[model samples]
Target chain A: MAKDNLLGGSLWDAYSNKVTTLMNNPQHQGEITEEEAAAHGNKLIVADFGAESCGDAVRLYWEINPETDVIENAKFKSFGCGTAIASSDVMTELCMGKTVDEAVKITNIDVEKALRDDPDTPAVPPQKMHCSVMAYDVIKKAAGLYKGVDAESFEEDIIVCECARVSLSTLQEVIRLNDLKTIEEITDYTKAGGFCKSCIKPGGHEEREYYLVDILADTRRQMDEEKMAAAADASMTGDFENMTLVQQIKAIDAVIDESVRQFLVMDGGNMEVIDIKNSDDNIDVYIRYLGACNGCASSTTGTLYAIESTLKEKLSQKIRVLPI
Target chain B: MQVYMDNNATTMTDPKVVEAMLPFFSERYGNPNSLHKFGTSVHLPLSKAIDQVYKGINASDGDDIVFTSCATEANNWVLQSVWIDNVLNSDKNHILTTEVEHPSILSTCKFLEEQGMKVTYLPVNDQGIVEAHTVRSFITDKTALVSIMWANNETGMIFPIQEIGEICKEKGVLFHTDGVQAVGKIPVDMQSVHVDFMSMSAHKFHGPKGIGALYIRDSQPLTPLFHGGEQMGGRRSGTLNVPGIIGMGRALELATENIEATMALIRSKRDRLEDALLEMLDDVMVVGERDNRTPNTILISVRGVEGEGMLWDLNNALIGASTGSACASEDLEANTVMLAIGADNELAHTGIRLSLSRFTTDEEVDYVIEAFTAAVKRLRAISSSYAKVGPSPGGEAQACDLLYHHDNDIVVKH
Candidate 1:
């Protein structure tokens, strides 16, 4: 149900959606019903080869059918993220169909190989294969139902950080909610990339990709408007060096767009060029203000003097200029 | 629509106290500070009133009492007297107080610490009570004072002040207990233990606001809180508020006269209200050691709702109460006292303090209970996620599944 909610209200909603989607997918969904899951009879088999103890493996155990395991069950387990979770998840599935002999054969190598087929998987490490195989053996032995000799009974997953489960979903949620655009932001938010600094090194995953259809459309529209405006400017006022200050003001006023009009309207005023006069080789713009600006106390403020100075700076005086 | 449950902040002036104040405010108003026959006549009643307050607290000597504007002022005068005396000129610079004490004591200790004094904050147990032994552990030869509140304003949890006072006496340390909430509601005697000072406010027990008294033991040397024209025996300054003093004295007299009957009635109402709330709502924790609480006060934290919003709803329905400490109501960092007592963030946010008086009737109790239940339900319905976790009336349960047998079929649904 949560998976159907694409645009969630909060970041937690996004997490719920992702978790729900992972649970519903048939591959990760083990072949067992919840009613069959009994807590007492079956031995507690943990898949600790994952990232950390609290994250993916624990979540998988919570979502998976408890009754499905014949002897291997995740009463306790741990994992890191992405591949480690996929590895443990794959190990859990492989254990469901086989007896103790065939189940123990499913190692980290097999889990990693199996995860390559999953759409969520990016890359796999060779050492994770050893972790998966060792964890599987431990689970078989811990259950006490497996008739085999193994190194350890329970899976060997170490709890590095306890504050956040620091598993796959935890880091993913942190990244998504915080909008971590840089590795520094990710490290600051999750603290996963900070500690031990093993799996979370830079370039471990490619930069997230976003679709740019809106960006392209906006760029094209802006370019077209700019081209038309430039064409009009070239045709109306090609050369302004030799024109008188009055003629120059008329040329510039012709191109005064709606932006200036809207800006003046926002200030409860408007402007019209009354005269452009020359004074001692400088051009001054004389403008008649309308509405509030015409009789306003601050009329002489930059509104008139700044405009005249800016015009002089842009178009050098052909002769003396002054405001009328 | 004013629903004020911030009674600990200050109660509405009692009508009886108001009536007593009116006559003094107009006619019969003479300067108690003056030396004339009219002044003496006013002074006579004022002297009798101070004696009455002294008797109310079971003080042996009348001279031990001093009337102040309010409890905070009394507490300040009592604690700051040590500083003014310059008594600890050579040694004894440490002041010990509990972590859950009111700001009057806590902030005063902090201020004293800034003045080259050491302050040891005794930690409290989960119940917000500092053991007498803990207070002793913080005391040393240099310890100047040990100040603890008589009853917590937020939870109404009574501290073992008698035992603490004995310990302070044994250590030769001055003990100043803030008895603002305890003086009128409960029996307090300044002479019973070797307490050097204690503070009380009239409003907590039905007097007008801005009037209180400080019980200063004669055995302890005291310096005036202010220097002025020989008022309040040169211990406190400024013109005496003759009307306010008379009203406070009267309030104390009234509270003590009906203390037993008032306690029984409020205890019954409080118990019934608490029982109803706990039975109706799950995950509600009654704060403090319930058995040791004052009869008229109940501090509870309701899960899955904001206390401020719940208080607003209760106020709309004319039910008065407070959340956290009345002084800390505006702060959202969660009650520091609640946190000091080991309450979680959720409990701190949802804490509601219900303090009743003799005026709380049986009908008001039932109305409050009903209003509280309705408010919790209403707030929960509007919350972002909790609305999904609880079963509304006519809805299925939220926790787990149930099975039903229908004719020839069986069905199970979560």
Candidate 2:
């Protein structure tokens, strides 16, 4: 690949796209009207923390803020992910300079409710309430006061969810509302995984492939090669609809073997069939090289592709070719 | 916290090395180029440092160690010196190198080829090991020099340099080995190997970058790559990168002192990681020869996933590893090393290189395995073809959406 195709334009252009969206969003800029500032007094400081990928802090910030209360000298900095960052930036403008007491009362719920009401913004994950709560906590802390008794340890209150800043309580709330069943679901609800993509998946399976129940047993049953050879030898096993899984694998293998042999033999090389393992959907085969391919740089690429492309055309889409 | 795993790219300067170099930049700053007593006094530590590096490599007393701005410069001096400067540049000029050789060698070979030199690219086996015979076969009568790497940067594959050098010597041709990645990490004795020239980069083995040495055996009267007033015993001329040179000496000494224990620790960790990852991801393939590979390095590929994406996800999780080097990331090409070892490009792209150092801890190793497993599983989830048939509902749909869309809204709810 060329450098341009790889870098996809300079990182400068990517940064520009991000900055342009930030500068454009009115909600992100917030309504910094003098009247609004005067009405809010010093209670308003914009607690602009991230939501989603930021996790607990953003949530806790939002949770602390129940309403769109203002705070004095209120500006927040966050280089958070996408819409969440923009939302936090907008939320900051919305809450600037009312008073400390007022700002502490605002919550992620209010911000999300506001986001949902705004047509331009996408659906705010129920979890984003945590971000607003985080913003509220920041305002309260900055003011050196708390409306509620300081029962939780600072570490306890400090959420670990830096992306969305969703607090422990906020995560629980979002989880309950969405009936999230897995860590993936939990991530979707609270946006704890929006940034790093660290939402733990169920189990440790490197791949999770789904098959319709009816086809699975049938595919597994077709593993025997004599049965597959019979099916491939049968003239009616067309397009693999009537063929067994083993038959399809063999058919694909036959095509690949022929193609690989043709290409390699032409190049003073030959391919060795290493191993074939049958799975429900695909047969994985590993190949070794003989002749020119043993030292050739283009052997794996050119020779393997010749094999794979030939197999892909002969077999159903399910068949895959792998190299040793 | 910012984690640095790209040590192969360049290491953070050791604070001790920094402290030692500080005075030379300030009050004690007298150019060694000067003839004054102040300059002459500075020569004591500088010469001692040079001796330290020489001692670390176990070079003979007669061997001439010449420092350069970097290993690249040193390599250029050793390689192109015989050709361009020493009157060996001709169509008959032949340079032999292993397929897994670094860009410094590869690019240099490319430049030499453009200048009409007949270059022979030696092939490495599936283990990334180049046999001695491979060099022997390429050694024509016109072969000027055979350049083979002491240790590969990506796969950490050690070559049979001594055997190659012995063969070249038998043929009466000069031999040069790039020992940049090998020097401090393993035992190297130039007196025993009897090679003409070898290049070592300070940074690759934990020294500071921008300073390296070219060990020219006493027998070879090589022409200078750079010519100027008295410097490097008139072999080359330039102001010394004093701090970088001093740092190299200290780094090499420290690394040599603990090489055995450090390698043992790395080998244990590397084996554990490889075994754990292989067990978790059953279909995954380990690259390079297990026995022949560097103890500190493990290169493995999880089938059906882009190594770059997997690496990004790992970094995002605060676990540092790479598809190859921090330098090679810009290319996004599959591992040329893996491809040379007969892995297809897809498999090569899926390759991940993990290098451990003396500084790497058991906890870090465990974290690496955990992080790698998690990230590989996650990235594999979005690799549509594999997930399509494997038994997870909606995996294909999720992977498809991830592939085609700017917004992962269909899959990631937020």
Question: What TM-score would each prediction reach against the true structure?
Answer: 0.53, 0.54
Instruction: Candidate 1: list runs displaced more than 4 Å.
Output: A1-324, B1-6, B86-88, B325-331, B384-414
DockQ class, candidate 2: incorrect
> Candidate 1's residue-wise lDDT over B51-130, tens digit each?
66987888877337777888888878766777656435655677777777778887787787777777777666777777
Q: Which is the leading candidate under TM-score?
A: 2
Model 1 residue-pair collision total: 21
Candidate lDDT values, in order: 0.59, 0.59
- Please compute DockQ, using alpha carbons, for every candidate against the native two-chain complex: 0.02, 0.01
lDDT string for model 2 (B1-414, tens) is 334555555666666766766766765667788899867767877887898898989887788888888889878877677677433534447777766787878788778788777777766676777888767877888878888889888787888888888898899888899888788877888878958889988887777778888998983578888788769778878877677677888888877877788778778877887888888886688877777777877778676555545665676678666674211233222345766675443445467777777777777777777778887665444332232222111111111101111111111111
RMSD of each: 20.5, 23.9
TM-score for chain A, prediction 2: 0.29
Q: Kindly report which residue stretches of model 2 are placed more than 4 angstroms away from their true locations once superposed.
A: A1-324, B1-3, B85-91, B325-333, B389-414
